[model samples]
Each structure stands twice: as C-alpha cells, then as structure tokens.
Target: MTSTDELLVKEITVSRQSSGEERRLALHQIYVQVLERQPYAFERKQLAKIEADFLRNKIGVKRFLRELGHSEVYLNAFYYNSSNPKFIELCFKHFIGRAPSDQAEMRRYCDILMRQGVRDMITALLDSEDYSRHFGCFTVPHAWAEASYPSPRTFWETEVLLHELHGRRGWIVPTMVWHDLQLNCDGGSCRLPEPSLSSAPSSRTAAVISGSEALHQVLSTMGPQDLAAFAATLSTAERDKLRHLLMQSVQ
Candidate 1:
C-alpha cells in the first residue's frame, strides 16, 4: 500500500479501541490533526478513503451516530437525528461559539456528513424561520462547503438559496450553470465547456442553452428519465428564469 493508505490504516487501528462515540470524536480529531500537519497534502480522495474504511469496519451506522452525538463536533448537533442529540447540540454550540478555524475544515466534515442522515436536519435548520435572522450573524466555515456537500438535503438548500437570493436579481446565470453543470455534478467531477464571450448575443445564448441543456441530458442518461421529463415540462418563463440563475452560477 501507499504511504497514505498505510497512514489511514494506522489511524483506523488506533481508532478501533475507542467506544463508538469516542471513535467518532477520535476520527474528527485525526482529520483535524492531519490537515493541520499536512495542509495541502490531505485531499478529498484520502479523506474519502478514511471514511469508507470507518464505515466498513470500526463503526456501524448506529455507533457512528452515537459517537457523533458525544463528540465535540457541532455539526453533529445540526445533524439532529443521530444517536446523541443533546450532546451533538452542545458540540454544535461550542464549535459555533469558539472555533472560527473550524469553517475551513467544513469540506472535510461535509464528506462524512453527507453519508450520515444529518443532511436533512441541516437543511431544515437553514430553511427554518430562524435561519435568515441568524445566518448572517453566524460563521458558515467555507462558502464552498455551504454550497456543496454534507448531504443531498443540504444541496437542495443551496439550490433554494441560489434561486431565492441570487436568482431573483437576474445575476444568476453562469454561476448557477457551473454549479448545476459542474460543481454539483458528481462531487465536482463534471467537465464544462469553455464560455465564449466574444460571440454575438444569439450565438452566446445558443451556446449557453446548449450547455445548460446538456446538464439535463446527462442527468437523463443517469437513469432518471422522470426528472428529465419534468425538466422538459418547465414553461418558457420558468426555463428562462432557471437559465438566468444557472448561467450566473459558472465560475
């Protein structure tokens, strides 16, 4: 195995001795320590490997939730359905109140969170009556994490925000397209065509439309014909609105 793989094995072996809750906390601490020490060396694939191994062996789903509840990781609190709701809440409160640096670590946490059932809970929190009044005052770690992962539910929340806050203003074209076509596609693996700003308005619009349409086509090819049909049913105005929003989403 590679050195990275060996390190992951070592981490898991050390983590195996802890109780379920302790194991979860230990894993998070390991991630934090690794990132602190290596900085750029720890990338997404390594993190994913660690999580897959954790899920496969050291902790079953229930135990994972239990650990999340007991750990100091506050995101666990937002992930309310876990085994230890009260403790998770406390951790969330502590993290929110104390560690500003935790935000940068969100992308790492997001991978694991996306696998757990916490995504919906976080989404509910974001959509709650309290979110707007408090979100601005709160620190959301990284914009990319807030925009990308943690769960399918969180992704939907991001989509809602894109439509409501960004879309309404007509500034929501390329960025939205980028998210829909690229960033949100398979953990940012989707390749996008280059934008051609030098083209005339008609050509540019056509190009954008083609790229936008390709996103749906790709999704359709992924076995969700119903969604593709639903996408097709969008009215001209609705399509225009979405296109405007998505186009703004590109980088």
Candidate 2:
C-alpha cells in the first residue's frame, strides 16, 4: 500500500490497543504536547506516579490536571511572575486549546480566580462540556486553535500568547502589551519608547525594518544612482522621518 494508507493502518492499529494502554499513551502525549518540552528525569517519575493514581481511579481528570498544573515544572514554565490576565489567557489556551471567545469569558474566569482560586478555575475548564467532548480525559489538547476551527479573536495569538506562557524561554518579548508601551533602555539607562506599529511604514520592506540592518537591507537592492533618485523623490517630511528612524537605530 501507499505511505498514506500504511500510516493510517498504523494509527488504526494503535487506536485498537487496550483502553488502559491507550489512556497511558494519551497521558504521556498530553505531558509532551501541553508542556511543549520533554520532562526531566524526576518529572517523568512524578508524572508516572500520578498516571498510576489516575489509572487506579484514585484521582479524577480535573484532579490529575490540578496536580500537574501545580508541579514545579508547570509553575516555572507558565505561572512564574505572570500577570493575572496573562495567566488566565494561558490556562484557556494550554488546557482548553483556544483563546477566550470574548472579554466576558476571560472576565468570568478571572472572577472564578478571585472568588475561588486557580485550582477551581482549572477544574471548571477541565469539567466543561467542550473540554470533555473534545479531549475527554486521555486525549492531548492541540495548540493550533485555527486549524480545526476559526479563532474567535482577530489574530490566532500563537506567537504572543505562547511567548506570554513561556516567558523568558520565548525568543521575543513583545515591546507593547495592550496599553503598556514599554521604554527600551540602553547601557546608559536612557529610556525611549519605540514607535507603535501603526506609525511604522506600511511598505512590506519598511514594516520589517527595526534598525539600521533592515534599512541597509532595503537600500542594498538599489544601485548607487537609484539611491540618489529615490532620495530625490522623498518629501521633506519623509526625509525627516527617515533621519529620525536612522538615529533611533544607531542609538
């Protein structure tokens, strides 16, 4: 048979394994997928211990997730020093595998946090009809919110939300978070807030230019005389803006 057919047959074979083996496999899958990293030696042992409890009916799914969420690795990865909104947003994404459908839904979870605690909020999500119907107890929740269903928000939030969840481990920490326009500091401790994206040039080449390197990349495409001709085409105001941007880059 073809590769696709062979792969499908293998998946079907795996699916037909005993429920106990399947559940253990699912728990292992959930650990890797949800945490987005391999578990450490001790972490693996702990997860196995918890999985034993889960399989033995000693703890329900909600309780199992609660214990996992409270573990040192989960706290370090997701919860350490995170703001309440960020933490709540992360819980919805990591556990429920979707962004909150609306501000009200996020607020409701925040309210749950204020009234009860993170434990109850997590349990409430785990016990939800949607979570049960989609993931049940054993299936790992997929992080690709937009692949299976359209995202409720305008953006998919894969970059921003994941960065928020992973924090320092993330490659980029966005300079702007909602209303907070952070001041970028230099070695001298001089603070200057970067211009908003709305103010950035709309051209594809210009949009990606954060510094002199990007500016240089754009200019590199022009011949020497073409550069002179382009400079001549710029309005006084545009030249001023360009100068300011160049200065920002060098600083």
RMSD of 1: 17.5
What's every prediction's RMSD, in angstroms? 17.5, 14.1
True-vs-predicted CA distance for residue 180, candidate 2, Å: 10
Displacement of the residue 26 alpha carbon in candidate 2, Å = 1.7
lDDT tens digits, residue span 60-86, model 2: 555667788767667676655444455
After superposition, the stretches of candidate 1 with alpha carbons farther than 4 Å from their true spots are: 1-14, 19-21, 24-203, 206-210, 222-225, 239-251
- Clashing pairs for predicted structure model 2, backbone only: none
Could you say which candidate leads in lDDT? 2
lDDT of 1 by residue, 101-145 (tens): 222233233333445545444443334343233332222211223
The models' CA-based lDDT, in order, is 0.35, 0.52
- The local distance difference test score of model 2 is 0.52
